[model samples]
Target chain A: MRYAAIEQWSRQQSVLHRRDARAKIGALLAFLIAVSTTAPASRIAFAGYALLLAAAIAAARLPFPALVRRAALVLPVAAGFALVLWFSDERARAVALLEKSFLSAVATLLLVATTPMPELLRALEILHLPRLLVLVIHFLYRYLFVISGQARRMRLAASSRGRLQFRSAAGALAVLFARSWERASGIYRAMLARGFSGQFPALAPPRWRAADAAFFIAAVLASVAVRVAL
Target chain B: MPVIRVRGLRYRYPDGAQALDGVDFDLEPGECVAVLGANGSGKTTFVLHLNGLLEGEGSIEICGLGLKKQNLAQIRSKIGLVFQDSDEQLFMPTLLEDVAFGPMNLGMPREQAVARAQKALELVGMGALLHKAPYHLSSGEKRRAAIAGVLAMEPEILVLDEPTTSLDPPGQRELADLLRALPQAKLLVTHDVFFARALASRAVFFDRGRIAAEGTVEEIVARFNWTQR
Candidate 1:
């Protein structure tokens, strides 16, 4: 029942964590937009953006290896799309496209590292994001790690039992998928019994004040500066 | 008066598997009853019908209100179900939110919803777990929190399915104690004979999607083929 791995990164601390999850999210969206708008040739702006992200990582107190690993796990799939840019006749343009994608990833990584997934989802709800999308994302975050953990155990058990051939891996994936589906179904039923309607009710109302406003304005200013400098 | 009345209830899964075949039963207010069954014996299907979660043939009335589509919201608000697996029941990120969900859905103000959630947690002796994530709680704690979620709704009839399946001995005993102290009508589904003995005043044995036997705790347990206990 312990969700240590899934819940571990979410440490509510410092002024950064206290910012309305909505504010952080809005800032993150703006940052992504700014990163995307910059030409890959704007090395100075990219460097400055990287530095700002590092400052955030430091404030968040996220582990370097953990953060890098999280980033790396994403890189391969994105690298494929980034690979597309490599074929552009103008090498600089290709470099720019690749850099844009990587910088975008950096923004997302920092957002997740600084703000917990659940809080982010709650913030999205407060911001009037689609309820169904928020619910799907929330459930995905909560259950993905748990389900993956189960999958890992299943693989381990199969390997130990001499069933870990290439052929067996597919079967193992199927089995894990089935189990997670069943678990999710049962959990949903249980939730309904406890008065879970389609919408998740907030336990504590999010309060906005001067500090929240300050954070929002500061984030927007940073995005504007990045945009103008690029 | 009976808190729950089920008459000739029939249910079939979408795949056409008969889950509950014309089952009839009654649960009095403020009394504890055990529903015993083998796997696929329709115990879960029967209990789910009590809250109108799964629609079936025949009728279920809770406190005299029919559990039809029109009466579902009212019927659901009055019955709290504790599912067998706590993990399935306590999926909210934090325990407090999970417990508060029911009352909040009932349209209680935020502060009142939170107060009721806290009170329910206190009832289950899980007050210290408010800030903790549901995934971190021990199985027993999760179970208590699951029960607290239903308790927060202030349901008149409390339904539990296999309430102590995977618990340690101490955890099991604690759950038994908690159930014993609960004030609402209890319709418990379980295979644990000892648990049935400790918790229920009466017992109903279900087999192959029908009620095979029903009587006082000793009478049903003694008369049935159940060897455990």
Candidate 2:
């Protein structure tokens, strides 16, 4: 029953955690756009963005090291492209690419870490995301656990007999895919049986209060100000 | 009148496999029936047709309404089919939401759906775990949550596929007790003879897409030597 540590962080009590998911999402979008558009040569702008995340992290009462570590996962891929830029004599752009990617990941992590996935998805739906797309996300999140757990069990069952080999592994992978497909169909049938007619109904949608709007507006203005001033 | 009436039900897979052939069945109000069969004997397929999930050549009348394309939704709302795998049935983020999913889909107001879901969860002894994710539940809890999800719809008939698949003995006993307390007419598609004996007043044995025998649980079990030797 162990879930991702971030999922646990999301349930913790904090002011940021209490905000409407729509507001956090809006603020996240503002932060990403602002960071993406800022000049690569503006080191101070990058610092401003980083500082903003730092303050938000402290305010949310999340562990700073854990947030940074999770966000750092984006760096290895960014570093590959950054290496190409570095060798082509675009060193500042390379650094900027790395910085921007990391910052964006941090901002996204902040939003998800503060809001539960269901809340985030509801916000996405309310913001006019396609119903089909939202449903896909919904099933993907729910069944990813089911499929992966099956894979783990299959792997154990295979390896326990001391029959592990490249050929057998490939065969097991194929079986996993087949089983997953079968399970997906069964899940679909179950959904239909329960009267699913396209829309994934929200049980209790988060209320958008004046405070949420104020937080959203403040987040956007701060990001814009940093992008402009720097 | 029977809560469920089926006549001449037949279904063939696209691969030319006849899953069900010329099946006839009836489930009366407040009665419980067990469908005993081998893995490929079409027990699941036959139950699927009851909820209109699988189309086949058949006449199905659920709670006095004929099964048809236009009547599919209403027919579905009248029968709750709990799948063999609890994972398949409970897909929402939280237990409450998952339970409420059916009521909401039935076009009930959000508050009413939630209230119904809560009541259903309480009935299944899962009210305390409303906020828990399905993945976090033990298999027994997941099964209960799945039943709660179906029960929230207030279906007149309950069809459970292998309800004892992964349950321990105590869990099985607890489930049987819980199910016995519910008033819905029941159809259990299972291989567990004891479970069948515990819940069903009558039984049907399916073999290669046909009901080979129908009688009391002991009668069906003895006729086929179905009990574990």
Best by DockQ: 2
| Top candidate when judged by lDDT against the true structure | 2
Q: What would the DockQ be for model 1?
A: 0.64
Local error of candidate 1 at residue A106 (angstroms): 2.3
Chain B TM-scores across candidates: 0.97, 0.99
Model 1: per-residue Cα lDDT over B81-167, one tens digit each: 888887788777778888888888887898998999999999999888787877777788888888998999999989999988889
Give Cα-based local distance difference scores for all models.
0.81, 0.93
Q: List the residue pairs that clash in candidate 1.
A: A1-B135, A187-B88
Candidate 2 similarity to native, TM-score: 0.94
Candidate 1 lands at a TM-score of 0.92
lDDT of 1: 0.81
lDDT (10s digit) by residue, model 2, range A38-145: 999999999999999999999999999989999999999999999999999999999999999999999999999999888888889999999889888888887788
